[model samples]
Target: MENKRKELLFSREDIQNRVKELGKQIAKDYEGKKILAVSLLKGSFIFAADLVREIDAPVRIEFMTTSSYGHGEETSGHVKVVHDLNMDLKDYDVLVIDDIADTGLTMEFVLEHLKAKNPASIKCCVLLDKPSRRKTELEADYVGFTIPDKFIVGYGLNYGDYYRNVPYVFAFVD
Candidate 1:
C-alpha cells in the first residue's frame, strides 16, 4: 500500500493538531448556541468523530450520507443523498462537516437542501479544501488545510474505498 502513494501530504500528528484547533474555534464560535453537527458520511466520519470530541460545547451529532464520487478520483458531478438526517433541524445552528471540498457541488446541494429545513444558520467545516478544483462559488467556514489539486487518499479520504484507514494523508502515485 505504501507503494501506491507518491508521498505523505499530512502526517497523523499534523491532522490531529489541526482538528483540535478547528474544534477550539468552533467551540468558541458557537459557544452559547445550539449546534447540530451534520456529518457528511463515509469520508468525514473519522474526522467528525475526532473534531466533536475536542469541542467543549454541547453538540448534537447526526450523519447524512451524500455521494458524488463513486469509487473514483473525480466526482461524477451528480450529487445524491443516500441517507438524510432524522432529527429536526429547525432553529438549530447547523455545521455541515465534510472530508474535502473538491468541486463544491456536493456541499452546495447539501446547503440548499438543509436551507429548506429552516435551520437557524448553516456553515460548512471541511478537513481539506482544494480551491483549484472548485466548480462552484462556495467556501467552507472552517478549513483545516488548503491542499493542492492531487489524488489524495488516507485519513478518511480514499481511492476506490481502499486507503481510508491510513493514519496519514497521501497522494496516489498511479
Candidate 2:
C-alpha cells in the first residue's frame, strides 16, 4: 500500500513542528491586535485548529468554503463560495489560512472577495506551497512547506476529498 502511494513528503511530526512554529510567529505578530483567523474550510480545517491553539492571544475564528475544483482535480480558475464568514470585518486583522497554495486561483478569489469587506488587514498562511504549479502571481505570507509539482494528499490535503485523514503527506501516483 505504501509503495502504491509513492513516498511520504511531509511526515505527521514534520507538520506538527511547523504548525507550532507558525503559531508562535502569528502570536508574536498579533500580540496586542485584534486578529480574526479566517480558515478556508474543508481542507484547512485541521491546520487552522492546531495553529490557533498555539497562539496565546485573544482571537476570533470564522470559516469560508471556496473551491475551484468543482468536480475535477484541476483548478477551474473560478472560485465559488459555498459558505461565508460570520464575522463582521469592520476593524480586524484577518489571517486567511489555507491548506495549500496550488494554482493560487482559489486564494486570489477569496482574497478579492474578503478585501471588498474592508478589513483592516489581510494576510495569507498556508501549510503547503507548490510553487511549480502556480499559474498566477501570489505568495503566501507564511508557509509550512514548499512542495514540488506533484499531487499531494494527506495531513488535510486531499484528492476528491479523500486522504485528508492521512497523518502524513504523500505523492499520489496513478
Candidate 3:
C-alpha cells in the first residue's frame, strides 16, 4: 500500500447506522424464524459481527472463506472455496454476508454451492456493492453501501492485506 493515498468513503458512525437498519429489516423479513448467517470470511468478519448483534432475531453464525483474488487487485475470474461450512443448509434460511460484491462471481459461486444443500431460502447481504464491476447477473438482497468502481480498503476490506484494521472504508486516491 506504499505510495497509495486514501480518501474516506464511509465513516465508522455511518457504517454503524446502516448496519443497524439492515439488521432491523432483515429481522422483520425473517420474522419468527432463526437464520443461519453465513459470513464470507477475511473481509466480512467485522461487518458480520456488528450486523448480527444489531439484528433482533435469532442468528446462528457460520464462516466460509472463498477466494478469487490471490495476492492481486482484480478477480481471477474464478472462485475457490478455501473453507466450507460446517453446518448443513437444509431447511435453513441462510443469509450470505460479504464485505463487498465486486465482480459477483464469488457471491454467485457461494450461493450455488449452498443452494445445493437445500436451504429453505438464501439471500445475500453485502456491506458494499460494486455493481459497476459486476461480471455476473446477481445482486445482494441487502446492501449497506453501493460504491462506484473504485479500489477500496478498510472496514474489513484491504489493500495488500494492510488496511483491514481501519474502522472506515476509503478509496485509493493516489
Candidate 4:
C-alpha cells in the first residue's frame, strides 16, 4: 500500500504546537501594528491559513503564485510570477509566508518585487527551511522546521497532488 512507502516526519500535534508558537512570536513582534500577510500559493496555502489564525494582531491575507525556472536538482533562482499582488503595500508591515525555503530563489525574487512597491517593512516566514539545498543566502525570519534535503510531503506539500491534505508531514521511502 502507499502508506508503507512513507515515514512520518512531523505529526499533526507537532505541527499544531509549532504553528501556535510561531503565531505567538509573530503577534508579539508586531504587537502595535497591522500585518499584510502574503502567502505563496500551492505549497503554502494550508500553513498560511493555520498560521494566521494563531496571530493575535490584525492580519489580512493575500496570495502570490510563483514558479522557479530550473531543470533538475539544481534550482535556477529565476522566478516567474504568475499572479501579482493587488494590495497597496505602503500601509502595513508585509509578511511573506512560504511552505519551504528550498533554493531561496523564489523567495528572493518575491522579496525584491515587493520591495519595489515600498511596503513599510517586509519579512519572510516559512514552515520548513531546507538550508542544504539553498542556492541563495535568504533567511526566513521565522522557520517551523529546518529539514534535511529529503522529499517531504503533507500539510500543503503534495505527493503527485494527493498527499497535500494530509494533516502532518512525512518523507517518502524508497
What is the clash count for each candidate, in the order shown?
0, 0, 0, 0
The residue-by-residue lDDT of candidate 2 on 1-174, one tens digit each, is 345746788888998899999999999988888999999988899899989998889989999998777646788887899999866797999999999999998888888899999999999999999999988898999999998888788878777757778888888675
**Candidate 4 residues 16-93, lDDT tens each?**
999999999999998888799999988899999999999998899999998763324345566899999986899789
Which stretches of candidate 4 lie above 4 Å from their native place? 1-4, 69-77
Residue-level lDDT of model 3, residues 118-145, one tens digit each, is 9999999999999999999998999999
Off by over 4 Å in 1: none
Q: Which of candidates 1 and 4 reaches a greater TM-score?
A: 1
TM-score of 2: 0.94
TM-score of each: 0.96, 0.94, 0.97, 0.93
* Model 2: how far residue 141 lies from native, Å: 0.5
* lDDT of each candidate versus the true structure: 0.92, 0.88, 0.92, 0.90
For candidate 1, give the lDDT: 0.92
- Runs off by more than 4 Å, candidate 3: none
Tens-place lDDT digits, model 1, residues 58-172: 9999999998899877799999999998767887999999999999999999999999999999999999999999999998999999999988888898878577798889886
TM-score of 3: 0.97
